[model samples]
Target: MSFSASSPVSFVRAAVDGEIARFLDRRRAQLLEVGSELVPVADALEAMLAGGKRLRPAFCYWGWRGAGGADVAGIHAAAASLEFLQACALIHDDVIDNSDTRRGLPATHKRLESLHAASGWTGSAEAFGRGAAILIGDLCLAWSEDLYQASGLGPEALQTGRVPFDAMRTEVMAGQYLDMLEQVREDGGVEATLRVMHYKAAKYTVQRPLHLGAALAGRYDDLAPVYTDYGLPLGVAFQLRDDILGVFGDPEQTGKPAGDDLREGKRTLIVAETLERTGSADRAEFLRHLGDPLLSAETVEWMRGAAEDCGALAACERRIDDYVAQATAALETGRIDATARSALADLVVAATARKH
Candidate 1:
C-alpha cells in the first residue's frame, strides 16, 4: 500500500524500533560484560538513537518496495541497518562539529563530559569526553556493520549495497576534510565551497542512500542514473535548508542555539555568496568575524541581513526550487511500483519542506 504524508509515520517508527531493539538485545551480553563504566556509554548511545525522522531508512524501505519486494522481514531489517549507520554518522558528526547538543539533549561528548565532571575524578574533562565519544562512535560504526550483515540480504545484494555504503563513509570524511580545509585556507572561493557542499552534504546524504536502497533491491544498474538525477539536487537543497536553519531556526525546535553555523564559521553557500557579492571592506569585516565562536546575537543578525541583502538567500531559494524540480523530473522517468513511487514522492516533498 502507498503511504502518504498523512499516513502515520508510526509504521516506519515501529519497524525501526524493532530493529534497534534487536540490535541492542543482541549486544546486551557483550555490553554488560564490558564493565560499569560502559553502562553510561550505552546509555548515551541509546539517547542518541532516540527521536530521529528516520529519513534514510525510509529511503531504503521505499527503494526496496519500489522494486516490487513485499518481504516485510527483509525490508524492516535493512531499514534498521540504515538507521544504525545514520546513528554512527551523527555520533561522529557531533564530535567533528564540537556540537553541545542533539535532539534537545547534551551531545554524546557533552554528556560524557557531564558524567566525567560528576564523578569528580577527571584530569581533563574535555579530553576525556572527546576520547570517550570517539570510542563510542567507533563502537556504533562496528555495530552498524554487524546489523547490515545480519539483515538477511543475500551475498549478491550485500555486496552491491556495501560499495555505496563504503563510498558514502569515505566520501563524507573527505567532504568533511574539504570543509575544514576551506575554513582555514586563504582562498576558499565560491567554487570551492560548492564543491565541498556537493561532496560533503549532497552525495553522501541523499545520493548514496538512494543508491544503496536500489542496490539492495537488485535494481542497481537500472536505478543508478535516477539516483544521480534526483538525489544530488535534492541533497544539495536539503543541506541548504540546513544552512538556513543553522542561522535562523528556533533553538527550541532545531535543538541548537540560533546562528550556530555562523559561530562555527561554516563557509556555506549562503556565506560564500555573501562574500562574493559584498564590497572589499564589508567582505573583510565578515571574514574577520566569521569564525568567532563568541559572536554576539547582533553580529549574527548583521550577517543575516548581509546575506539577504546580497541576494544570497534569494539565490539559494532559487537553487532549491530548481533542484526540487529536477528531482521531480527524475522521479517521473523512473519505473517503480506505483504505490512505492507515490510514497517516495511524498517523502521528497516532506523532506524538502522541513523547517528543522
Candidate 2:
C-alpha cells in the first residue's frame, strides 16, 4: 500500500483501516495464547478500532510525502499505529467523564459493566466495568508503542519518530487533566478552554502526527515549523467543529447523545463564549443546567437557543473560519512539494467540516 501524494483521502483511510485490522488481528492471536479471559480485551479493542475517520494517519502519510519520502507500505503501518494511542485516550476519557455512550454504543465501561452483570460473578458490576475499562485503556496505551516499533520500519526511522510520538501521549494526558480541572473550577473561561483544546485535541490530533511522519522521513528539522503552521490552526478548527457537533448534531450522526459535552460540563470554547455573551440572568440559568446528569430534551433545546441568541455559536464559527484561513495560507506558502501540499489541502476540509 504505497500511496502517492495524489492518492484520495478515502483511499488513505481504507489503507490505514486495513493495516489496523490486520495488526490487531495478529495481536489478538497473541493475547489468546495467554488465556481465553483476554478475549474480551481483544474484542473490545477490535470494536473500538472500527469506523474511525483515520485523520491522524492521513496527516502522517502526507507529511512523509511532503518531506520527499519514497512511497512505502511501512509508512502506512507506522501511521496506523497512532490509532491505538487515540483509542487509549478515548476509552479513558469516557470513564473520566462518566459518559453513557460513545459512537452510538455503550461506553466501554458500561459494556463491561453489563457483561459483569450478565455473568453474575461480581460484587459490583459498575466497579468491575470501570476497572476493566481502565485496564483495557492501559493495554491500548502499551500496544501503541508495540505497534509503532513493529510497524515494519527500520529502527532508525522509529527512533527518529520517537520524539513526537512520546510528546503526543504526554501532552494529551496533560490536556485531559486540565480539562477535568476546568470542569471543577467554576470560573473556567475561554482562555482555559483554548489551552485544553490545543493540547488535548489540536496538537495530538494533527501537528504531532505530522511531525512523527516527517521525522521518520529524516526531514523533521526542516519541516517542523511548516507543519506547525499548517497543523496547529487547522487542528483547532477541527476540534471546534467537533464541539459544535457535540452540542447541535444528530445523535445518529454523532454517535453520542445530543448535548453530551454540555452534560459533561466541558469547558469548550463554545460554552465559554456563550456564557460570556449571555445576559447575567441567562448566564445564571445556563450554569444551573450545565452539568445536570438528568438534563431534559426541552432544556437542551433551550440551551441551544440560548447559545445561538448570545452569538456564541456564530462567534465560534467565525473563529473556525479564521483558523482555517490561516492554515490554508500556510499550505500555500510553506516549503512543501506540490503533490503533498495538494493532498494536505484536501484534508483540511474533511477534518473540519465532518458531521461526526
Best by lDDT: 2
C-alpha lDDT values of all predictions:
0.80, 0.88
Over 4 Å off, model 2: 1-8
TM-score of each: 0.94, 0.96
Counted clashes in each candidate structure: 0, 1
| TM-score, model 2 to reference | 0.96
How many backbone collisions does model 1 have?
A: 0
